[model samples]
Target: MHRDTGRDVVVPEGLLRIEDCLDATGGIALPPGVTLISLIERNIANVGDTVAYRYLDFSGPTGGHAVEMTWNALGVRMRAIGAHVQRHAARGDRVAVLAPQGLEYVAGFFAAVKAGMIAVPLFAPELPGHAERLDVALRDARPAAVLTTSAARQAVDDFLAAMSTADRPAVIVIDDIPDTAAHDFDPVNIDVDDVSHLQYTGGATRAPVGVEITHRAVGTNLLQMILSIDLLDRNTHGVSWLPLYHDMGLSMIGFPAVYGGHSTLMSPTAFVRRPSRWIEALSAGSRTGRVVTAAPNFAYEWTAARGVPADGSGIDLRNVVMIIGSEPVSIDAIRSFNAAFAPFNLPRTAFKPSYGLAEATLFVSTIAPDAEAGVVHLDRQGLTDGRATPVPADHPQAVAHVSCGHVARSQWCVIVDENGDELQDGGVGEIWLQGDNIGRGYWGRPEETETTFHGRLGRTSTSGSHAAGAEADRTWLRTGDLGFYLDGELYVTGRIADQVCVDGRCHYPQDIEATVADASPIVRRGYVAAFTVDGDARVVVVAERAAGTARVDRAAAIEAIKAAVMRHHTIAVADVRVVPAGAIPRTTSGKLARRACRADYLRGTFG
Candidate 1:
């Protein structure tokens, strides 16, 4: 069975049967290599002089300098850095990248692969204002060397100084290494199953869970994204302000580089400082053709609400495909972006709602380019009762969820109940995935890996068990997210770990957080975390204050929030805390850390 994804690009045949699709298409594929290093070598030989990357430095001494690199130039630096790495590390060793976002980071990452070492991409310590997460990751990976540029040498030095000599790795300064050194180092023999990189789960604060991504998994995912998104031409360029350590950023850059596509890079801090920079880059790229870019939901809302020009000068977004992924897909965020920027000629189809995680090597399901996002309103009470009952727009309990489009060609998605029985359509349960894109699992944690990566569907007959041949796709990935399907499209509700159960009815924390955020003017949007305390069926919400407001009347705001939840879904709020702006903890990808917030509440940290 096939479904149309708005574009003439039809979802591949037998989309529901992922295992069979893989059996059919695995032998004949192009664009991605058997190994990432081989892909780099292929690009160097084919498009050596084409502009591969462009880094925009808004705060450089030259005042907005553009540092460009050709594929040939990058290859030379890659080999030189690889030669330097070979001096201290052997093949299959781990190498950590801690450089600031720029060309140096790119060179160092490719160099690790060229030297046949597993690359661990992490953020520079000073950029995020702490090294706690880096400390955790350093202890986990225990790399042979650390890669950084002169710009971040001091910060890296300071961080490594705290560690014992035996625990510390040699720090390699990328800029100091002369490109004139030997660029003809022998290529290490690499297999498709070799580990390419270790993508740490969250940045700098939480205990890092290194996801061991293999060369075959990454290469297969790139091909999946390219074919599913219909990236036929090499002329299409990518503009990204996301950090290099993030899976989204790394995979986005990886796809273009492997297929000889050009990309424009900028610091994430630069984008936050001036969101208009992202707009300008997109507008410029659109002139040549459709520009490709991606970010989380918050970025779209932030750029649209704060970045779009009042007079609309230097803004034309006609040919831009900005994919929204990472966190839970929000309908209000999409509407807010379209309403703010649509007046400037941005099409309604520009916002592509997407869903993915680190376990799947980043790119998962995304809306097609030609269609507007599909949205449906559901009754809140019905949702808690395990039913996706549609409600009228004016209904008191109505909630809207945007579809994450169809899964990639060879990927299968199943919504299952607690006992591992597959659910019928409209039954919300855990999301299970089966595809080549799934990673090898967490590094050095086989027990956790087996439990998460190796899951089996209920083999017994049930009301919702897949009819036949579904047993072939038995080995599935437990996504840990809760969602359902309606009319063949996937809709993610929230995380299983974050689902709040009150009065024996299941409720998503995001739903409660959204209600509180919209309940009062004082509560900050996109910064609310909803959780529960021990011995309580009532919900607790921790929210930040909006900027430029006078001291809020906390009591009045609390009453309004409590009243709103009661009116909307007949729920009670056990506690409501409104702290200073930016008080809530967030992952490096800008998602609210609900578990951390709960721990802080228990410890009275916000008090």
Candidate 2:
């Protein structure tokens, strides 16, 4: 039975089942009034000699060797880094970490947290002008110090040399620091409410914002994840290739592994260039225990097409729980992956589609372990007609997307219209969430913080008194996502901001792009993009044809796409610009960054 508690759907029976699991497992109860750093410190005391991190130092592009760091060794390294920072930087200072993924990055992060400093992590220099971008972030954040590796030292030095002396943070090389510095200082007491990190949101200056997440908020979110997903069992180990800078990568995988005393394998670029390595790691790691890892929706499609072998020998996917998130959840991607990996004994139920954001400290809802990955097909016309009508799989123009599942224990989610009124089931609306896991607010910008974090819906309190005004007492986060709840599960449609309105009708760009993708051989499925141009919407497609392929004969491809889109949505495409393969902009986690692409298009760089 489901009970609507205004903010979330309560499953009382599911809560009982989780409690039973917790009782049987005898898991660590999170002691009150403790910081995230304390959890790591306590785990080190108990699991001193156990392996905490496994790293591969790729000397060159050809070959590399592996190294392991025990819990004791990692703790010692963290303390040393922390001590160095404490001596050089002030408490509550922000420290920027710019380096490739490795053991050093992990150590630098924890050390900052231990020193009562906020760690600001950014991607390594990859794209052109990345150095300039890093410099901007460093200057804006005014970090006390910048942590980098020996290899990155020269690059960082060069970047700093270009900036004024007063604008640069103190650059510190991890390899140059002495190990003896670890014992020089005593551990300081940390408050759970202290800011742990300042996570920057993706966007240009007009929309730039950073969410200030506190230790208590992160810890509470992790606890909710543990309770909701049964992650406290010793048999479950965490593995991730998601970049540590992102909130999902940090809080969901990194913090959980550290605090839960479970071993984790982290590599930033490993899964992106070669997804098979992730599966290989998962299979090999699962011999000791079950492996839990996560990636965005595209990774599943990419890996399914290239990673798994046909015969399925030497691959065991049965014990792997692949949590897919960080972007729009595609039912096609999930089903395709399941079918592709089924020969390797991959369980259909192992694909977990979840919903979350940085404001919630990462996870807000997750699919139940026993439940099959959820998918719902809606009638396209009805969806555009201001209502959601579930259609059969065989129906024409049926749009299928995966559900993000039930809400987290410490959080509540709701679907509300633009007026902040609750929408009935199957009505697409903005996703609003409120709970302890909600982050403190965006850092530095009070106006943006108030607008983003403190908005409301008028509702009678449990005490039976009506609260008037938008900011009465309850606060709900405006997720800016369009989705609906079906049978108690939340299925995200697309971003509300991404929707293009024309002639009194709302058109989802993703849907138009998907239709275009189906009609053209050159256009890769899920590679077509649709965005607004001036006042009208335009379609930009990136096809997978050979680099030197002739474009003169592709008129039919364009015509087919135009016809399909017009037939489906009655919206004429303003223009169709087809570029070479790999032209689409994607996030580090493999999510298609449509906004980034639009920015690139405006700059005339997307060809």
lDDT of each: 0.79, 0.70
- lDDT by residue for model 1 (1-607), tens: 2322221212222111113224453532322235676666556656778888899988765557789998878888987898888887888889999998998999899899878899999978896533667888888899999999998899899989988998889999999999776444555777778899998886412466899998877877877776656665666788999999998899767866556767899998889888989988998898888788889888888887779777738678888887888547877788888888887778988878888888888777877767898889999888888888888887878888888987776677788889887888888888888776788888888998998899887743355433333347558889888888787788888787777777777687788888898888888888898877875565888989987655677899999999987777677888999988878887787877777778788899899
What is the per-residue lDDT of model 2 for residues 1-607, given as tens digits with 9 covering 90 to 100? Answer: 3432221212222111224322234442334445666556545555667776766544457855667777667777877888778776898899888877777888888888878799887755543434444555666677888888888887777777776787667887876878888876456667878898877665421243567888877777877776666665656777776777777777533543334444455565566567777777787767776777887777788888877764635877778888888446887888889988888778877888888877788887879978888777889988886577888988887887787888776466777777877777777777787776778888777887787788786433233111222234668787777887788787888877777677768877778888887776767777767877676545444444534446545778778878888898787776677777777666545556667777778898855
Model 2 ranges with Cα > 4 A deviation: 1-30, 57-64, 127-136, 204-208, 252-260, 310-313, 459-472, 537-552
Candidate 2: clashing pairs of residues: none
Clashes per model (N, Cα, C within 3 A): 1, 0
Cα RMSD to the true fold for all candidates: 6.6, 7.3
